[model samples]
Target: MAKKLSIIVVLLALMGATAAAQDAKAVLQAAAKGMGTEALKCITYSGTGGYVGIVGQGYSPGDDWPKVELASFSRTINFDARTMREEQVRRQGNYPSRGGGGIPIQGEQRLINLISGNYAWNLQGTNVNPQPAAAATRQLEIWLDPHGFLKGAMAAKDLVGFERYEGGPSREGGFGEKRNILAYTMGKFRIQGSINNQNEVVRVQTFVPTPLLGDTVEEKTYGGYKQFGGVKFPTNFHHHTNWDHEERPQGYFGVRDGGHNSFGITIANVQPNMCGEAVTVPAAVQNTAVPPVRVESQKLADGVFYLTGGSHHSVAVEFSDFVTVVEAPLDEARSLAVIGEVKKLIPNKRIKYVVNTHHHFDHSGGLRTYVHEGAIPVAHRDLVPYYYYAVMDLAPRTLEPDRLSLYPPDEFQETFVLEGVQNDKYTISDGTRIMDLHLVEGNPHAVGMLMVHLPKEKLLIEADLFNPPAASAPLPTTASAANTSLYNNVQRLKLNVAQIVPIHGRVFPWADFVKIAGSGKTN
Candidate 1:
């Protein structure tokens, strides 16, 4: 009788533990549902706020880029889960209204409204009325509940319970693929929550993750809630992605203009069909440069030389004590070639500052090599912390983790000055000669773009806005709006530009830009 009783007690204890584990599993499932299941269904909200983006800087050791900041942006979204229809509208500082004068009619159309739906076309660019991918919505489901059971992957399961008794500390999270010298660390944090009888999660006390600027991280927090719709939503979203995490589908490069980069959806409305259609391939763009290229250098001004051929254009400047290269084109191999050429031109002079034009992946991707070479990157002011904390520090460190690994950690032995002035006019001068860094104002290229101004040569070093027409090509018969915008900027800044040297074109006189803008003519 005594042995039997002992056995029964042991069995009861095991049963209790099993029950607790099952409850935890249910709570986790609810959490996952909150992320995708519920959030995806909720719609029709308007929000007005500001956002920031971090770009370029560098990927190697000790290199950093600048951040782009924007204020006064608003959005409105409308969603119908039962019919799976969404609509969105967006308005920016002084930009004209988008989306057929307000709310779109017919079919599901909103931002991030991922229902297995097809694309529906409408007014203004591409209007996707019904997203075709919606057919697979049920199959492509994602779980967001923190404690929810994942469909597969034991690693994910383990992560959910890494600190069941008490919340674990927050570490840097990976965004996309990790790369060399890109800082990627989050602030330390912990969480506490309770599960209801129905396996629903409620009252989650989230310790905020800190956003690092250059080398500093700011701590933040969020408190989630269980709403009546059988879903949990982070009633408060507090953590900021290195880039602005707004659901809107448009991006502005420089200044506000009447042109709208509407990918078809707004805040309160979502056009999931428009999601995939947002990226359009510029049809007219054709690369005619030679292959397995070689480099050709030309002296544009005193201390400033334009290195062309070998696939890309790079401007090399002889600074007071070192040589500064404006842009590092292409990947490590290309950067290595650039380094070799710069060394040959000015023997023993170190390549100092690599001033990136913007943060697009293509333009600033090669920054890792500079970081490894111990060169500091001078970028826009807003991107400092993101470079130091989110990109370089915590990024993946193997398999071509970039040249910066040649050095040690915290050995960022350089200065990355990100400018903050939003004026149309700015200059970096060495007293005798002044180099103006003009914001492209209303450009759709990249935000906070810097155009190098050479006053003595009356030259402008720019990228993406306009390229030189081929030597054999005839002058343009029709004007391009982009060309007109570039001209407007020149007039706005009052830049006495004579020569226009694009990063991807043969040399051309500013008169050419004027002709293209003034009368749809190109030479």
Candidate 2:
């Protein structure tokens, strides 16, 4: 009887899969025909709209990714070559230099991001920087497009379809039209998209792993379709990332305001097969391979080590019983490398705490790895909403299933492990080694920025405040807000600092910082 039951289940699943495939093909065919993308091989779209927001550069935790004026934006997607090139000309306009990532552009900044097959690179003037890390997501952007979604789904595996009601019911809660949902597994990414009653591919989304949100939500919505040649193109395009990092109110997908509203554009022109000649993979980028995670340790003081290798750095402070790591930057591989280095530096001691400098994604990305190792994250109280509840199993992390999610420690009770720093000052001491966490006052870069100070060592561990340029590199022309803020805060806190161990650059004496940061405030 048991054998018969198992056989019945297998047959039922097979039948269901066949039915799903049949339904998926019919739905996709209709959407392709309705959108007039049945014969499209490539496309070029251009427009002017500033609403391109940089993730992790928002004014506050809940604020939308900071926006800037894109004087012009254009993208070319080649289905045949499986390549994408996006060009944007951004200007400072009204945006200020508050957050990181060169926010306040004095003049026009031209950017060209190119991805072909397995390689990704960026072009700025005559420079070519290999961005191998960005290849996966950049490639995904191609399929996120409306017509590309159909083409990708047609070749995808395990394709299925279902009817999705926007609200409670087909007509309940002011819902407009019925949507046909199609899902498939393409490569390592599982894509799910919806077609509206008008047969337009209105939404395409997938789960991407993120340091802050774990299984972060990445979605693209399109509307305002207009005919360009035989193909119908969307005049309006909007992108949302980390959409579910916080709870969102129930509603059909619409233009709403939140940190997740990453980028938007109003298309004015669309040309088919105008993607131009195939983008040649530059030799420089082609020769570059994904670099391995390397942690080069420089002893800052007794039991204090500066972990630097790549663009970012972390400091591992050793204590009698355990260790504390400051500024876990980048992602899993980086944090893992730093952790291994910490173990080698201070063997047989547990990593007790990870001091987060700020809530920026780049700085806080590796906190989860430390949390997985049973280290409590210490951040500004304002970030409790962003980090405290974020580590929990709020959403399914099936996309990548971080080690923490897959195998938490036996003592882990699934409780929030974040330790919030309050009242501008949080101290960690064993009556011998003292580390002071002071809130950076009047800095527009981040609201809850904290700079770690070891009084006895006269060492200040800071990030974003001042990333000292290489000794060989030329000095900067303009003084930055972050540098000025650091100069003021060092004085405001009245802490003596001899050597500044920066999380971004090599260790430099405070005198060098004085030259770059200078004195006084910015208007």
Candidate 3:
């Protein structure tokens, strides 16, 4: 699943109380006054826009933040309000670009552009009724309230009160919709909006539900604006969700906001007319990718041959003449290829165990494939049950999933094998090399993450943390805190880590980790 941007940026601006006195019609009329009919009817203002939100199972306080940073996306939208003909192009970046392919928003629903006019999909979070449905789904049906906030808001009015805030032409976007707070009896889960003089909604702020945090007034904000051709929309918005690291009373909040969910543009340089075009895979492209090349596989003690996979952070252990692959990095495609390579080396050995480092979607993307291939996943106790019941339960197998969908055998215990080994630990052994799995204590990267240790190889298999660069590339300015904690765990465990195999980066000396952590050295 794609990661949901954080909620910090949503609740940036708060609408004071008292919007309860006004009705929806009054609010729409006043907003239309600011955004003249011309601008509202055929809105066309373009700059750069983005959006952000939170993803993964319900966030746990103190869990590690997302490893791969949230996607920074950009896009533009064009909507001929009169014809309701929308055209859009979405790009992924802080600043919008033209080279990327556009996901068609108009004319089809499945092709909904997150950044363009269809951002209404974000409203899915609002528990809105069935979204406008259709055939192939190349477009989405957005229910616009006759007044302009969101059609669902009308029903929301019964549950919450409405209040209009006093503000002039705003800079968040051009002068559009402003004022009106739909306050709820629960807490500050209000609707803050702005509309142009033409009465078209230029923006709407659906604050995140409060009172969920219990005594914590954590607020989330939403924004929308009308871009090209009078499509009233929420261009700039954010949310303020509670962060895990800080103490309960004295809490620190993380801003989960700012990444465009959809885009539609009319500009020539940016958008190209839609025609059947396949993305060209450039020939003779600069091959910067470091293909995994096996360095050395030494037999340490009986039957325990530590088989290190090529350059990437993958390792294989030979136990009782059978093989157990730990860490399937990249994706299903990569994992599948890796599986072939492993079999080539160890002929006809069924992959008995596929140990997962963590569940960040990427590292474990090929999990289902492993399960289908009959590899019992050695995972954290808390994660196994969720995977079986939730992640592995249903298959929306549109595009091919990384792994085949094979439910465990008939007598299969619903919950797979996931138990703490020692110190919240677990291990897998084939009467050969004992592969120990231990959860990194106090790491924020993931709640129940495992760090693999091969006592015989004296090699540690980890994901995300301390991925040593091939030729000493500059260290990323902001190293993940979760990875840092993994290092701390290594010290706590006092295990001899001769080589550190990172799931993503090239394997490097464990000493490289010491250099970076202790002296802040990258090279």
The candidate maximizing lDDT is: 2
Q: For residues 183-299, could you state the per-residue lDDT of candidate 1 as single tens digits?
A: 111122223344333333332332221111121222122234435334333333232222222221233222211111112111222221122222221222112112354677898
TM of each candidate vs. truth: 0.46, 0.91, 0.50
Residue 321 CA displacement from its true place in model 2, Å: 2.8
Model 1 TM-score relative to the real fold: 0.46
lDDT of each: 0.46, 0.83, 0.45
TM-score: model 3 vs. ground truth: 0.50
lDDT tens readout by residue for model 3, 1-523? 1233334333332222234335554554455443332243222222323322223312232232221112233223222321122232233234321110121111212222222222122222323222221111212122122232333343344434354443445657666334554432212234444444444454444322111121112232334444423333444434333432232222222322112122222221222121122212122112222344343444443433344454344566767756777776545555666677667667778888888776554556666666667677776765554455434433334223233433444444564443333457766776655878887877645557778888877778776555566675765454345556777888898888887766655556777666666554322
Worst 10 residues of 3 by lDDT: 97-106
lDDT (C-alpha) at residue 210 in model 1: 19
Which candidate, 1 or 2, would have the higher lDDT against the true structure? Answer: 2
Which model scores highest in TM-score? 2
Tens digits of per-residue lDDT for model 2 on 1-523? 9999999999999999898889889999999998887789999989996467788767667667777888999999998899999999988777666676667777788899999999999998889999998898899888989998999888887788999675233444465557999998777788999898888888899978776657777899898998999888889988888764345433312322256877788999999878776899999999999999988998888999999888899999988798999998988789999999999989999999999998888888888888888898898888765565444443457766666677776666555478888798999887789999999988878779999999999999998887788889886655677778888889887889998998887888887677666744342
State how far residue 328 of model 2 sits from its true place (Å): 1.1
Model 3 regions lying over 4 Å from their true place: 1-51, 54-74, 77-231, 234-313, 401-403, 406-423, 472-483, 520-523
TM-score of 2: 0.91
lDDT of 2 at 449: 92
